[model samples]
Target: MSKDTSRVRLTAGRVEAFTCPAGKAQAFLWDTEAPSLLLRATPTGRKTYAFESRLNGATVRISIGTASDWSLDTARKRAAELKQLIDRGEDPRELEKAKASHKAAAKAAATAHALTVGDLWPDYLETGKPKRRDAWKPRYLEDLKRMSAPGGEPKKRGKGTTRPGPIYPLLALALVDISEDALKEWHDNEARASKHQAARALMMFRGFLRWCATKPKYRGLVDNEAGRAPAILENLPSMKRRTDALEAAQVAGWWAGVEQLNNRTASVYLRALLLTGARREEMAGLKWADVDFQWRKLTIADKVEATRTIPLTPYMAQLLATLPRVNEWVFASTKTLSMAVYNAKRRERDATQAGRTAPAGEVSTVSESGRMSDPRSQHAKALLSAGIEGLTIHGLRRSFSLLGEAAGAPAGAIAQVMGHKPSATAEGYRPRSVDALRPFLTQIEAHVLALAGVQFDAQVEPGKLRVISAQ
Candidate 1:
């Protein structure tokens, strides 16, 4: 019953009676029956069975089990085995440690075999970074999530409620089920509703499979090329690149209609798209610092490269000059304007009246992810207003290139302005100075404006700037 007792022989009754010393963190009592056996107690009086002995002239101790779990006889038997190890000059503690580790590894290997694609997906999304950029683009990341999204709530587009993510069917599947036959069936089933979307989703799923093959835990599970099965590839839709662009005669009217857009930022944004020939996102991320009226240049975020610079023409400058500096963007919409579009305020009000707190960190409806939402509806309206139609946003880029070509601007010059790969040798020879590139950009702007009949001299913008979805 005491730490130094001549070893009262260990019995169920004596074991139950042992208690930890009041001031010490742990207390132990050695059993006379098995000198190597110990009864250890924590300050809280909980006790466990353990064995202590010496090997290679050093004391080695190994825990057995709690008194509640191990009978005295069982503990004595374990002590005898440990004493044999000690007699052989082997550390029992080391052997105990190795045994525990081996058991753990065996359990882990079994669990790893059972891990599924769904199990690894969350980690993949968290650690995944795009090749072209530092992080995944919001919409693209969303597409990754969406293609594999679970089904529950009624969706915005469909009739009989929501469809499960295109990847959902494979989510619950075990890694062993990821075979060419499996992927082929999933593709064909998905292609029935929309071939293009299914094809795109398949591409993403394939990427996931490849990533899994690279991971040690999943390396054996995926075939890697399971997604590239000829059946799945052959089943995908034949996609043709879209060739939409603005016609020359539609410029003036399109420009006027976009100018008339009520939301000032959207107006400038639409006009900027046509004027700069920058991609939609490139224009959306335009920063005030990147725009320099003194030098007459606009450095835009470019997907191909990191960033690209193009001349800021007179009309484009005028359009920007009139815009409100809300945040960092040269063009930003008011929260009121954003809420009005998404009816976020109404939804928030409705949510408030229902005694529900807003969903935490819910995205603002105004900027569809820090940039203007799809301009299709409003753009279509503008086209209608101008008595024109069929001009996609990118069509403006095409329009700029074609218009520049017709106006005698060199292809390389226009290509450089549009942030193309610059295939023409003339592009390499084009002057690097902003002053050198100025005339080509100016002429292109002049031609587009003349066609659009939007003539204006550059005006001094107020020294203030605003922050918008320059995300």
Candidate 2:
């Protein structure tokens, strides 16, 4: 049949027969049935179906598929669709690109929806910082990790695998699926085990969700209000304010119990807490550099500021001066059996590696972070010995405030020494200098000593602990 050289009625036989000219790199045969439909052939016998059209005065070429994949009828129909798009003032290439982009976005959304709290926990822990602080405190950071930790690992101190943390179950849930219903159920389950711990875990998890809301990639997936749902809030246990502290009458017995303790450092540390009204952690974190023997002042790490300087009374100075200078810490824990064993193993390893005996007296003098930790049990023992009940280590701090007032010290002086933030009040809102606080502190210490029926000369040299009476 007569036909144009480059165009012809395409058929199964003609399609198979298409091939590039020997000298040409490629050739095309346009379908007469569909103007833009054509079969392209390379010299190597590779073939494909393609559509070509012009839009905005530029040619748009799109590969339909290979000859094996696109049937003659199917490729022609696709070519017809492309022509209709071009007629409607739409570029087929642009429409195809838009479809591809939409498909990719949908896929990304699906991926985000499948993300679990566990997936982003590491990133959150690394980047999430508390308000008013540059980074998480070491202790609070440890709490975060412990709250989310999976169970089945051996306990650090006791036998048996540790229980999963309160926040552990929620880690497996998809971020988007952490709805109010999900959280309510989670809180209900965890509260059954420990309401306070569950409440703490919920608080921590909410911080994580708030962090997620700040991130562009995770913002859409997290529901910040889910953690604050009324259902969860209603189930939370009522928080009770602690008012437990030593009464004036309990001082003598408590002092006697604390004095008889085997741990000399702890006995003095407990007394220091009562004498100075310092927080448990703040006093435990004291370093030698923070103490000023010459100035009779102590620079303690403050909750309200970077550090606070308080008058170091004669009694408190005597207590601290007697503590062993074992390390940098004023209340350093004694080296335990575990520490000795580990050090011995390490020394043996070093000797084996070097082919000689290790140096003498290489030992770790403290098991934990050089500072004293968890004196509650020891305090409990002393309380038991004294027949006192419900008095916490923090109770001693509260005791100081009450005793200091009974000593007739000004409210502001007591608050300043205890590192309390000053409030607007007639009682004394202004801060006090170290010298201004010294006499009041000394008065409070003398009052406490008399109430406990203990008499010791304040003029005695440091490192001397002499109690003439404990009646």
Candidate 3:
């Protein structure tokens, strides 16, 4: 052992040297008593802290922290700790390793504590909401509401029940708090009630966690939890293929049944779904502005990317011409119209009683003119009344796709009309223009209308059907 130069205070620009038979190295202790107090300098100018001291027939060494952060007090304190451990018959080297591990764990826990599921949800909404046209679809929003609270009770939005939104319950826990076991429990319980729904929830939750991992606050906590969660769906359940497509033979009978529907607006809405291959919500929420009569086109902002433009087949055009425009909505309600008229009447009476002249035509029976009805409740009631079995509003869009395919429309053209992403091969190519797609869309619309026995100008010449609309 080298003699201690107690008179000299270890400082920057000062180094102390010692030699042992084991190796010849110089210990450069920084001026401060910082954790990174010493550095071993080689004759070749390579510097490291590889110094060791033997205590009770065992070797012990300390790593003064890096030069940048070490202070004189910190280094001296660490050196004393190591010395005391050595004195107590503990291996200082083992003690150093244990201290390092505890520090690392504490640092990780601090980072985990800083992040919570609530913090990540807004980001998920900002990035993911664009994927949906109406971010709050009734069913999807309803699910979100259930997951927000502990018991899945519906929240009150003013006087009405708030719709559920996305984000599952387990996913809403703090990222650090979520463990593989918790996720497994949630998945198993959800699966018991509805396997397909559980599968969907897992997928959505996984996406949320993935977003969490990329954020600085939750980075380390998110990845491992998400990675460890078991795959909820080993395989998606197979759907039973239904041959529910309307046959040419059934066209006349279906039309007769549809015409007898008591709710004229619902009948028109269903026919529009079949005629234009528009999704039910798109047609139900159809506004007058979306219809371009001059261009013979109906433009719809779709759920996915881009707006879908379908040609207005002659039959569909004729149907539109006959309908009364009640409001901005294409299918406004009679009750709402009556309510508007009643309000106008009250206002007119107050004006007359106050000796003030009323504006002409302000109190007309057509007060709520040009608006449309909410198709959902009405459509359901109509379906029940018509005895239309195994049919849904969305089913019309699917039927349209199938019938279009059978009638020989290209898959890409059908997908574009249906607002689906183009297939990989098609995506590689330039997107087809509305004009380029017009002819195929016209054929599809004609085919669908024909399925409902609504004739158009295009004649389905036997061989021409194959050539004109090749699927």
Candidate 4:
């Protein structure tokens, strides 16, 4: 009922005895020691410590804390600090906002700093580069992605029967946790069922670690030496590099059998691989745009150089020209199969925008697969028909090199045609132009045709069907 007129030294006892005015919306007790600091209570008896000051000619008031949480001295100190800030023409609210922002930023940084390798893998696949090659080859990129895939189905042996990814378990581990011991454990487990695949996976993972070390975001977070640890390294099974090549005597049988294949496109695709010595994926992923019939050259995806142009020999041109143009793919297949193509770039672009999808209709290069399928069984069937045995699909590529050599083409010429960097001195001897390589490719094709006991008049224009004249 009566207005209090004096300032008081605030205390626990004073604070406990303070009462709210029944008639007023709020009441205040100004501290005598700190005049600007006050204890305010609502009519319902809710109390808090607060500070008041004039800022930019306007009275600005700020709530400090409740009487229970903050002592009298603490409130006084806060009031003084606010007073000084106001005197310096600084807004206390801006300072508070800045402090809050800094705290939030620190929390966000902590969250990001501990990002797992799995967390960064997707973006890295989209943008990260490895030391082995400039951009990731489609096959290698697919392997990296599938390695960490959260597996689509359950396994039969483990928790259940499904094909889980090899690297899926490691996804939960932080990038910093990929130590030598962790890698050893992973290697031991993987080796139990598939030693060779595990060895390959470990090698791939090492490259990933090296890539992580180069990134500022992941620097010092990965111990790349983990993959090279002696415990894991010693367990790696020694694998012999396969050197299967098509024998000159077998080319005849191989050619006859490949010609009899039900899938003509696949048949030609196989022979093309052998004829050009091109990598399997490169030949399978061939686009119509990459084929320059006018220039008699085929531009193919090269592992060593990203891409390279090989002389499209007369026989090879005829084979390609005879095939139907299903889409952008030169060896287009109508049959549906799972595609392991689309690299990080395609996948990333797809995630951002919906359209511009892969080879489908006009945009699509091949069918579900952008490249040719492995023709192992079909090739085997052809081989059996031709009375040949024990020839693997990849042997066709080796055949091209061997046959090229037998035909007197230099090692450099074969390596260049095969999309290899040419480890031999023969391949390293001056770059062979498409024109220079043409003769050797043509000669190899002729010799293979002769072995098959079939002859073609390459003088005829490519893609022109030869009809027998009626007598």
What's the lDDT for all of these models?
0.75, 0.86, 0.59, 0.76
Clashes of 4: 12
The residue-by-residue lDDT of candidate 2 on 253-285, one tens digit each, is 999999989877788889999999999989999
TM-score of each: 0.55, 0.71, 0.58, 0.60
Model 4 quality (TM-score): 0.60
Best by lDDT: 2
In candidate 3, what are the lDDT values of residues 320-343, reduced to their tens digit?
654545566666666655665677
Candidate achieving higher lDDT, 3 or 4: 4
Model 3 vs. true fold: TM: 0.58
Number of clashes recorded per candidate: 8, 0, 37, 12
* Consecutive 10-residue window with the lowest summed lDDT within model 2: 361-370
* Candidate 1 wrongly placed segments (more than 4 Å): 1-115, 118-172, 184-197, 210-225, 228-238, 260-264, 287-289, 326-328, 334-371, 421-431, 457-471
Q: Candidate 4 residues 326-445, lDDT tens each?
A: 466776653522232333346657856876554332222334434455667778788888787777777788787777778877787777778776565463467788999889788877
Q: Which ranges of candidate 3 are over 4 A from the true structure? A: 1-101, 110-115, 123-158, 163-168, 176-181, 184-199, 209-244, 337-388, 424-432, 455-471
Best by TM-score: 2
Ranking by lDDT: 2, 4, 1, 3
Model 1 C-alpha lDDT per residue in residues 1-471, reported as the tens digit of each score: 344434678888988988876777777888898999998888877899988877666667788999989999999999999898888878876777899999999898778767777987887787766555587766677788988888776765446667788888888887878889988888898888888888998888888887787787788777898888877777667776767777787787787787677766777788778766788878877877898977778898876567888877776776676664445556554553565445656777889999998554432434332445456677877889988766788887877778888878877777777777645435464535566667888888778877876544344453232322110
Once fitted onto the true fold, the runs of candidate 2 whose alpha carbons sit more than 4 angstroms away are 1-5, 10-29, 39-48, 53-61, 66-74, 84-91, 131-133, 151-154, 246-257, 260-265, 282-312, 321-389, 401-444, 450-453
